[model samples]
Target: MLASILMTVRKRRQPIIRLALSTMVAALLLGALACSPPEPVRIGFLGGLSGRVADLGIGGRNGAMLAVEMRNRQGGINGRPIELIAEDDRQDVEVAKQAAGRLLAQKPEVVIGPMTSAMALAILPQFNTAGVPLISPTVTTNALTGLDDQFFRVVAPTAAHVSKSAEYHFRENGLRRPVLVCDLRNKAYSESWAGDFRTAFERLGGEIIAEVGFESGQSLAALASSVLAEQPDGVVIIANSVDTALLVQQLRMRAADLRIATSEWAATERLLELGGRAVEGLVVAQYVDRGSTSPAYLAFLRAYRERFAHEPGFPGLTGFDATNVALDALAARSRGQTLKQALLTQASFAGAQSPIRFDAGGDTRRDTFLSVIRDGKFESLQ
Candidate 1:
């Protein structure tokens, strides 16, 4: 009778033990789910991450990604982590449109950029319709940052900037009349810049003594001769910096005494590489100092060299500084809200660059800096 009772007790306890084991397993699963982090704050970087301007896009994304990583390390925004989504626009307009659409579908907090002017123009209308803010690292066309408040570009609008700088260079050098040598028949940068410069110069008591245009992949020595025959006080040449160097070399071959009063884009290492000492007497307007050699710049150069196996290029540094500022804004923004409001509330933003306080229209009315090439290098002309 006692043996029968023991068997019965063991059978009942076996069921209880199984039930307890199942409850423990369920509890463990629930605990793990609780420990998992909240949904990540999504940010997308849209740029020409492939093709010709890939260097610029890659550098910009690096700075932005670094900012996101740093923020995540210190417990993210409102305790939610950050994630960056990047795509290559290939520096093509149609591709930029498709990439922009793809990124917007991900429902990111903010979209970083579509770098070039063409790309920016392609994405602008879509971003405007979606009410999504596109913080551009580089689109510097004057018509872009127009009456619309949504067009926020970190790069100085080249057309307006060149206008003022051209006026200054002309007046300071006492160049009354000038010849407008343009690469309009070919390069996009040349046509727009030449148009803006001609208008600005004419408004500032300067006459266009002669006008000349060239086709892409083709250079003419005769145009330089045409410009010289007019005997203008100085020559205002507008072309893509790389092509500009080729034209300058050809122009210098024709006339040893050519003095230029021109725009900012001409100040790249590309010009010096092609034209060499011929570019020494050349004056240019610059927003960034190539010869900065400051602590921040030096540190950036070192880091860039480490990652890229080379020094930073012109647009690379600009894109780096610009994207980093936006990322800093993201990290410092208020929690529990979309990034747009936080960016709008930022009264003042600072980075390795100058203090960037966006106006209502998101354009900077900043003064232009001048630089003169000396010894095959750039020096700020204060």
Candidate 2:
């Protein structure tokens, strides 16, 4: 009887051991599957995040994020979630090159932004070599206009707007003698803008009193004093918002009745906040018409305000447009077509600011507007 009882006990324990072993094997398989990598469609974003030009970079990054979020919410590209790898170049050329390399390492299908023309030029070789399409949102230099590379921009070259501005000031405003002050730090855009404006103004029977340049980390007060000494009828300031505001403040302090105009680069809201009353009545060229009532523009404005808790400026608008271009290309790719071919074939992209139609040189023709700062807001002068 004792032997029979022991045999029953051993048989019951044998089944329990088998059951525990089976549970352990199943858990292991589940864990392995959980640790597996996810497949995602990647897009690389590079811009200056920490530097004097951080505003532009931050705006661009936010815009790109908005695009990514909107696409993901709408089921993403062919059900594969889109990923954005953002890198800060700190507004340095070498840093931009390294950042481009790091972004390219992930093998992203497309890249968006370097914010400035200099950074775009620095990182162009990397994207071109890797055969990745790069869409620059705010690079306005004419240097890359006809380059047969993968680089493209949402904004038109500086030549067009600056020339128009020159005509507006000389022929319309009757500002015959103007002084040109440019920041060498962003020579890629500023220099081009100043040069184009000078050419156009001179051609339109206006005189450039003096052309002065200020480098980064230099004293703006002295530059402003020197420019004031020229007693120009109107002044054309070609610098970013920060420097532009400083120069404007200095100029206004010295001469209360001074007339000032600026390039599109310095036409952000930050300029009004920084320059205060000094920027009032200041003429500036802008790529976006703030008075647009289009459905696309209004929708973008609403979404941007909700996400970022503020208004979107040129940088934000252009960034959003550039990313949309990239997303459209990605969508085409999902249907077994390539983004490059679509872009080169003159893809029609409806942007928040305007309808985009790429030309043979991969540049878009945008309508720039003249605006003046009135009561700390941009009022269209056109």
Candidate 3:
């Protein structure tokens, strides 16, 4: 009888031990919950933040962070704060790829952009392979977006802009026997734009007198003199602002009868600032109005100035547009849509530059606006 009583006591002890252990585990879990911090959803900005294009990216990042901050102030998406991780591409393709890789390692919900067509093209294949969507701020080569199901952009295709410019200037303005000076060997955007200009001009019954390929380091004076000797009707330059401005100034000095037209890449304040009076009467083709009167553009311009203490250019606005779209996708992650899909859904976005809308093929086809420099500013050619 005594042994049976002892066995009963031991069984009671076993239950008490298990109950105490469960209580300790529950307390530990509660403690962990109290100490752990909520994870913020990481979004990556891939761009040339420190090189020649720093102005372009700084303004873009500023605009995007403003949007994110506004969203966060509203208590965030599903109680998760959005955080931005910016990586500098230095305007180089190899550097862009490395920057993208670093961003992907952070496992961002979406990647903003590499900013240059060449940079975007170099980094997209990796993101696509990983099923991560990339949204370009302004790299509009069309080849980047139309390549796969993963790439997208808020900026209208630079190629289409080039084509439209050629169409209007060659057909409407009667610019026959034009000189084509393109930055062929630098980036795909320029090369493609040059081709489009040639095709459109010839199709409109205009002749290309001389097709010249100038390197980034070539002297604008020499190039202008060489092209002027050909006695062309107009000058079509498919290059960046650095080269474009130099060429414009040289052409202004050499030829009074020559008309100058630059592509989307040359749409920067640097052109007007550097080219000075030479940029006057020069036509620039772009997807967005430089001096836009829309409320959205005005508001964005204000915000960008407040954040960065300066005005935004066309590239900066494209960055903001791309960022806002990507952020919208990220905030809506619970709805089973990706950054690419959200952008590609043909949703019209009132961007700082223009009303941005992208097709299913990741191409953004928008109306081109022709603007001319007047009084040191770009004015709509009404």
lDDT by residue for model 3 (30-90), tens: 9999888679878888876774456566656766677777678887767778898998888
Clashes of each: 0, 0, 0
Question: 90-203, model 2: which lDDT tens digit per residue?
Answer: 888988998999999999999999899888878898888888889988998989898788888888888756778988898777899989998887788888888898889899
**Residue 361 CA error for candidate 1 (Å)?**
1.9
Each prediction's TM-score against the native? 0.77, 0.89, 0.85
Those runs of model 2 whose alpha carbons end farther than 4 Å from true positions after fitting are: 1-38, 334-338
What is the full ranking by lDDT, best candidate first? 2, 3, 1
In candidate 1, what are the lDDT values of residues 1-382, reduced to their tens digit? 9999999999999999999999999999999889987999888888766643555577567756655665678887778888889989886667888998999899887777766666777788988787677887656666665545456767666665777666775678677777777654223455566677778877888887777776534645666677788887778776546556666777678777777755655555666777786677777766566666578777776766676675455555665666655666667766675455666677877544456666666665434577777888777777
- The positional error of residue 339 in candidate 1, measured at the CA in angstroms, is 2.6
User: Largest lDDT belongs to which candidate?
Assistant: 2
lDDT (C-alpha, whole model) for all candidates: 0.69, 0.86, 0.76
What's the distance in Å from true for residue 220, model 2? Answer: 0.8
Error of 3 at 379 (Å): 0.8
Task: Tell me how far the alpha carbon of residue 294 in candidate 1 is from the true structure, in angstroms, after superposition.
Answer: 6.2
